[model samples]
Target: MSDSPSLRERVRTEPRPHAVALLVALGVGIGLATVHWVGLVAAGALASLAAPTVRRGVAYALGAGVVALAVFAASLGPAAAAVPGMRPVAYVAVGAGLGLPLLGSLARAAVP
Candidate 1:
């Protein structure tokens, strides 16, 4: 018999880490909240490293961005109401946060 492992065996060996993805996303949210713009990029890069695949990394980034936006809105409250334009900015920030990490993961996946 051949020594090569079957596709089913490979799949069984490689289990996805959903919990870790969520935890990393939560950390990204916190980083986005406390740090400057660089924080978002950092979080994305970190998430890419933590996730097993590009798709998972993208999901993590999106989830983290949403959570961060919610925290930002909740904390700013009336201030956000005063500056409605900032709402759009926040959405853009979330998009950027997700996009950069996805790009990073994509690059990594492509190279390796």
Candidate 2:
């Protein structure tokens, strides 16, 4: 039989989670800054690609989501004061901010 490593072995041999997480966060941050909500999903897929394990991939994506939301809120500054007036749109915004990354992270499971 061939001597190629299994998926788990490759995953286990990948870089440490901290490094992977940091890289994922940076990508997520850039994505958020340039592409808006679409960036979260991109970050999720990116996290999945960078992480050494599926669990860590999801966690990184979630962390990126939190960071994305925090940065978005912070960037809003005084404009954020009007958020309460946004009503249902705020719910969609919050949901998308958190949900898209998780959705994107699913790529890890789908991929080899």
Candidate 3:
């Protein structure tokens, strides 16, 4: 009795929009999202839109986090190797890197 199409129906029709959304998300995330941690949230929300379902979107964003970590390490240069010695703080930083995006990716469920 629900007015909306089932999840299956929506997923089947998903790809075209995903392609466009992914591009815009990347543009905004890379070129415009310079607000540090805030940018991570925005990037996750945009990446979520590029998936067929909320779960998939979250997964995509999580994968993006791995890329983000690599970029961060690259930016750190030789100092990156010293990260492991930070112990407790490094744990928090890594967790945030993964978690913030997952938190933002939850926005997918709120959208169409």
Candidate 4:
């Protein structure tokens, strides 16, 4: 027989700390993202990184991507309609900006 508590018992005992951490991360992410009203993408990416769950992470990523796309399309509609070649730049910018939050969340998760 094992000496440690069962998985359910462990989860019951350790629920609050991780929940608090996740909430803190989520708050920070949402705050930063809402600052310029353009960081939703970053927030979403950070949300994914804050939680270890793959389903949650992917949902966050997709949500962020949709927000980014909408923001880009709205912000650059005129230019895009005129140039027809700046779409790639928008993609790159969104990717880079969103990547920052992901990296930040990952770093936070790495700490003890």
Candidate 5:
């Protein structure tokens, strides 16, 4: 065996279902942001690409939730910071509204 892992070897070691769930969640985020229903459609399609079970769904949802929060926070915070005398409510709201709810839902669902 090679001391260094090959690409195929690395791939074989990955958790396949976890990867698929992330793709689904990311698709959902992109779809909603772009108003491209096709993205959501694709997300749903890829979701099934994972092992069809509650665990996979929840994992994918959690990954997507985290990505969405990060994206939203990055986008909103800079804009809010640029404004003079802005109370930062927009940034806070984006973090709270989008990030918290999705994460909470996924966390709750993840509990067996």
Candidate 6:
């Protein structure tokens, strides 16, 4: 048999969940700042695409969401102070940020 690694083998040895999650979180934060909800969902889905399985994608999404939430909370004060009615927006953003990852995971699962 040939020694070349298959796609499955390559994917299996790719970055771990924590690393993927952290990267996803960073991208999600940037996306949230620039493009709002659409960016957040896209970032989460793209980031988790590297996962070897749906279960791992879900876990990575959760970790990414948590990190995104922390970033959102830390930045909330400045945003809220600058804009009126920012609290409600922040709440929605945070919730969406958390939930979008599940959608991303699902999307990942739906693919091959």
The lDDT per prediction is 0.57, 0.73, 0.71, 0.53, 0.47, 0.64
**Best-to-worst ranking by lDDT:** 2, 3, 6, 1, 4, 5
RMSD of each: 5.7, 3.8, 4.8, 7.3, 9.0, 4.1
Indicate whether candidate 4 or candidate 5 has the larger lDDT: 4
Q: What order do you get sorting by TM-score, best first? A: 3, 2, 6, 1, 4, 5
TM-score for each model: 0.56, 0.71, 0.75, 0.41, 0.39, 0.63
lDDT of 5: 0.47
Model 6 clash pairs? none
Name the lDDT of candidate 6.
0.64
Pitting candidate 1 against candidate 5, the one with the higher TM-score is: 1
- Per-residue lDDT, model 3, residue 36, is 70
Write the residue-wise lDDT of candidate 1 on 1-112 in tens digits: 9998654334323455545544654686466647676555555555544555667666655555556567666778778776556788766866765665455444334522
Candidate 6 residue lDDT tens string, 1-112: 9998665446545556546555755576456645566655665665566566778777766666776677666776766565446678767776887888667667568765
Among all windows of ten consecutive residues in candidate 2, which has the lowest summed lDDT?
6-15
Mind giving the per-residue lDDT tens digits that candidate 4 earns over 1-112? 8798754334324666546644554566556665764455456545565444555565554555455555556766667575446678756766755665444444323421
Q: Which candidate number maximizes lDDT?
A: 2
Indicate the worst ten consecutive residues by lDDT in candidate 3. Answer: 26-35
TM-score of 5: 0.39
Candidate 3 residue spans exceeding 4 A from truth: 1-20, 30-34
Q: Which ten residues in a row have the lowest lDDT in candidate 6?
A: 9-18
Could you tell me the lDDT of residue 99 within candidate 6? 86
Assess candidate 2 and give its TM-score to the true structure: 0.71
lDDT of 1: 0.57
What 10-residue stretch in candidate 1 is worst by lDDT?
7-16
